[model samples]
Target: MKKTILGLWLLACLSLNALAENIYPISREMGSGTRSAFVDIFEIYKSVNNKKIDAIAQKIEITNSTGIMLTSVANSKNSIGYISLGALNNSIKPISINGVIPSVENITNKSYTIFRNFNVVTKLSNPLIEDFLAYTVSLEAKPIIQKAGYISVSKGNFKSKNPRGKLIIAGSSSVTPLMEKLKESYVKINPNADIEISQSDSTIGVNSVIEGIADIGMVSREVKESELKKGVKPQVLAIDGLAIIVNHQNPITNLTKEQVRKIFLGEITTWEQIQ
Candidate 1:
C-alpha cells in the first residue's frame, strides 16, 4: 500500500513539471533584413523544385524589433530564437549548430558559415563621409567592435580626415547597437560632429540614403542588386555572425542543421521528438 501511494505521488509531480514547460518559437517580422538572411542561409523556402510554394506553417511569435525578441526568449525557459552575435548577452544561451559553435575564432577562420556583412549605403561621397568611413576600418575601431561582440573589417590604408557635420545614419535594427558604439567613439574625436541614428528596416535605410533622407544608411546584409540600380553605393562595414539562441535552462547542447530546419518548419513540434 505504501509503494502504491509513493508511485501516485511521483506521477503527480511529473505531471506538474510537464504542465510547467512549453516550447515557444520566435521569429523576426517579414521585412527585416536579418530575417531575410536567416531564411536564405537556412534554405527555409517551401519549394524543392524551381518554383514558388507556400511558406512553412508554424506557430511562431513575430517580433518587430531585436530587443523584443531578446526579451521574449530570455523570459521563456523553453523558447528558441536567433539574433546577431553583436547583440548577444548572458541573458540567454547560444547553441552549437552542426558540431560548430559561434565564435570570433570560428568566424575569422571561416568555419562559421552563418555570417552577413555590415554595409553602408550612400548616394554621393564627400570628404566628411570618406573620413567617417575610414574611421570605421581603422585600428582604433577594431577593439570597440570586438568588445561589442562583432568582428571588425580589415584595417584599411585610408587615413582619417577631420569630418565635422551633422551625420544621420539610419537602418537595420541588428546593426543599430554596433553603430551606436561607433557613433560614441566617433563623436569623442570629432566633437563638432552631430550623429543621429534611427532603426527602421534595412531596405528603408537604403532607400533613405538614395532619397536624401539620411546621410548614410546602415544595412546588415549586402546591398541587393535591385537597390544598386537606384544609384546607391555600398561600403562594407564589418562582418557579423548570427547566433542561434535558446533559454539558458535548456539542456540540449547541440543541434544538427537538419534538426533546426525541421523544428522551424513545424515538422518537429515537440521537444520529445528530438530527445
Candidate 2:
C-alpha cells in the first residue's frame, strides 16, 4: 500500500512538470505576428516529439520599452528572443538552428524560415502621408530599405514633384537606418521636401500616427487589428528577419523552434541540457 502511494505521487509530479510548459512573447522583439507564428511552430514540433517542452522565459514584461530594449532583456542566458537584424548590438547574440544564423543572405534567399514584411503606415486622409507613401512605393526608396537591413518589395522609379512641406516620420530605431536611406533618396528627387525622422518603439510610433502627430509611421511589426479600427493602414514596404543571436563562445549550434521556446521560458537552463 505504501509503495503504491509513493508511485502514484511520483507519476503525478511528473505529469504536473510536463503540464507547466507554455509559449509566451519576449518583450522588445520585433514583429508580434512572427512571434505568434514561432510559438505555433514550436508547439507543433513538441507535439510530434511526444515530449513536454519547457518555457524559455516568462512573457517578457517591460516598463520603459522598445523592441531593442525588450530584445536586450530576452538575450540573457537560456533565453530565446527575436529582434530585427538591424537592432542587434554587442549585448545580445543570435541563435543558430541547424548551424544557420538568420542573416540577410539567408532571409533574402528564403533559406531562413522566420521572416515577415514590415510596413510604412499612413493615414488615407493626410495628403503628406499620401505623398510619402507614394515615394516609398517608388523605385527610389526600395533599395534604401534593403541597404538599411530590410528586403524591398517593389521596384520602380519615383516621379513625384517635391512637396515643400514639413513632414514627420516616427518608428522603431531598427527602422531608423531605412528611414534615413529613404530620406536621402527622397531629398535627391525632391530636394526641397523637409522630412524629420523620430525613433521610438512600434507601439509609440503607431500611437503618434493615430494622434495625427506624424505624417508617416514606420514599424518593424504589423499594425494590430485594433489599430486598423482607428484608420491606420499598414502598407508593407519590405520584408525583414528577426535574428536570435548568442555569444560566439557558446558551443551549441542549431536550436529547433521548440528548443528556443523552452530556452526563453526558463525551462531548460543550460547549454549541456540543450545538447
Candidate 3:
C-alpha cells in the first residue's frame, strides 16, 4: 500500500508540473503597423465572427516596441509574439503559418500574405524632403534595404544631394530598426546633415508630421485617410514582412492561419489545447 501511495504521488507531481505550463499570447499595442498588418492579414476580427475586439485586446502582453516583443517571447518558453521579419534573428524561432515560412522570396512571389510597406511621410511642399524620399526609393538604397532584410519599392536613377539642415524622423517601432540601418548609411554619405529618429508607433508618427514636430515620419504602414485629410503625404520606401515567433524551447510549431487567429481570440487557451 505504501508503494501504491508513492506511485500515485509521483504521478500527481508530474501532472501538476505539466499543468503549470501556460501558453502566453503577446501582441503589439494599438497604432502599430505591425499589429494592423497582422490583424488585416489574419482577418482576426472577422475570424472571431465580428466578436468583441477584446478577443485581441486581451493579449497576455502588449508591447509598444518590437524589441520588447522579442524580449518577452524570448524569455518565456511558452510565449508567442509577432515582429518585423527584418528584425528576426536567432534569438527566437519563427513559426510557419499555413505551411508558409516568412521569407523574401515568399513575400515577393505573393505566397506569403503577411507583407506591408515601410512608408515615409512628409509635407508635400518640401523639396529637401522630396529629395530624401527619392533617395529612399532609388537603386542606390536598394542593396542597403535588401541587406537589412527588406525590399525597396522601385528602382530609379535619381541621386539625392545632401540637404544641410536638421531633420527629425519618427514613427513605427517596426520600421525603426531598418530605418536606423538606412540612416547609418545615409549619414555616412551626407556628413553635413543632422538627422534624428524616434521609435514610437505609427499614429504618433503621423501626428508628429502634422504637428510640425518631425520633418519626416517613418511609418510601417500606409497613411490613414483621416491623416491624408490633414495634409500628410506618405511615400512608400520598402516592403517588409511580419514573423510570428515563439521561444526556441517551444515544441509546437507550424500553426495554421486559423489556429493562430483562434489562439489570439482566446478560444484556444493552453499549450495542451494546441498540442
Candidate 4:
C-alpha cells in the first residue's frame, strides 16, 4: 500500500515538472555564427526572467531520416521550437523571444534583437583557416552572404594578404556561392593554397564544426545560448532581406507593417478588405 502511494506521488510530481519545463534542442557549438545570435537573445530571456531551458528535452523518437523529423517533433503543441528564419516552412512556429518575433525587418533594425549573421568560422591555429577567414572578411563576399540571409562584417582588403597552408570550408547551402567566390578569387592570387568546400544545413554544419569535421561551418541562422560552450566563432557576413513574397497575380504592391501583422495573426483574410 505504501509503494502504491509513493508511485502516485512521484507521478504527480513528474507531471507538474513537465508542465513547468520547456525543452529546446539547440546546436552544440560556442561562437557558431547562427547559434550565437540566437543564444544571445535566449540569454537575455534567462537574465530578465528566471526561466530555465532543458537542452535535451526528450529523446525524440524518429523513424525517418530527414530535417523535417526535428521540425515535426518541435511543432507539437506541447513544445516550443526554433528553426532558421530562412528555412521556416510553416511546419513549426517560433515562440516569441522576449516579446519580439524573428523577422527580417526586426532583425535588421535590432528591434527583434535575436537574429545573427551566418558565419564562416575556421580554426585560429591553422594558417589556411586564417587565410580563408581573411578572405571572407573581404568586400566581394558581402553581396553573396546577404543573398543567403545574413549580415556581413564590413572590413577592407580581405584577399590582399595570404596565410601559409591548405584551406577547408564547410556549412550552409546559403553560403555556398560566397565560399565558391572566395575560393576562386583566392586561388588566383595564391596558386598553391589547397581549398575545399563542403555543404550542410545549419544544424549539421554546427555539429561538424564541434566534431572537428571541417575547418569552418556556415550557418543560416543565429545560434542559441546553450551552444556557446563549443568554441566556434560566428562572424557576420552580410545583411539579408527576408521579404514576405506574394503571388505576382495578386494586385497588392505594398503592405503596411500593421496589415502584414494582421494577416499573419489571422485577423484579416480577404484581399478586397486590405485596400
> Looking at model 1, which ten-residue stretch has the lowest summed lDDT?
51-60
Off by over 4 Å in 2: 1-56, 59-81, 88-93, 124-127
lDDT string for model 1 (130-248, tens) is 77878888888888889988888857544556666788899999989988998898877777778899998788899899889998998887788989999999988888898889887
lDDT of 4 at 245: 30
Tell me which of candidates 2 and 3 scores higher on lDDT.
Answer: 3
**Displacement of the residue 184 alpha carbon in candidate 2, Å:** 2.5
Cα misplacement distance, residue 34 of candidate 1 (Å): 1.2
Question: In model 3, which runs have C-alpha deviations exceeding 4 angstroms?
Answer: 1-20, 46-55
Query: TM-scores across all candidates?
Result: 0.87, 0.71, 0.87, 0.51
* Cα RMSD (angstroms) for every candidate in the order listed: 4.1, 11.0, 5.2, 15.0
- Model 3: per-residue Cα lDDT over 94-118, one tens digit each: 9887789999889998888888888
Candidate 4 residue lDDT tens string, 116-201: 45555543446666666766677766665555445667587665455557766777655565567667877887777888887655
Q: Cα lDDT for residue 19, model 2?
A: 34
lDDT of 2 by residue, 180-260 (tens): 777778777777688999887666678888999987777766677888899888888677776765533333457776667
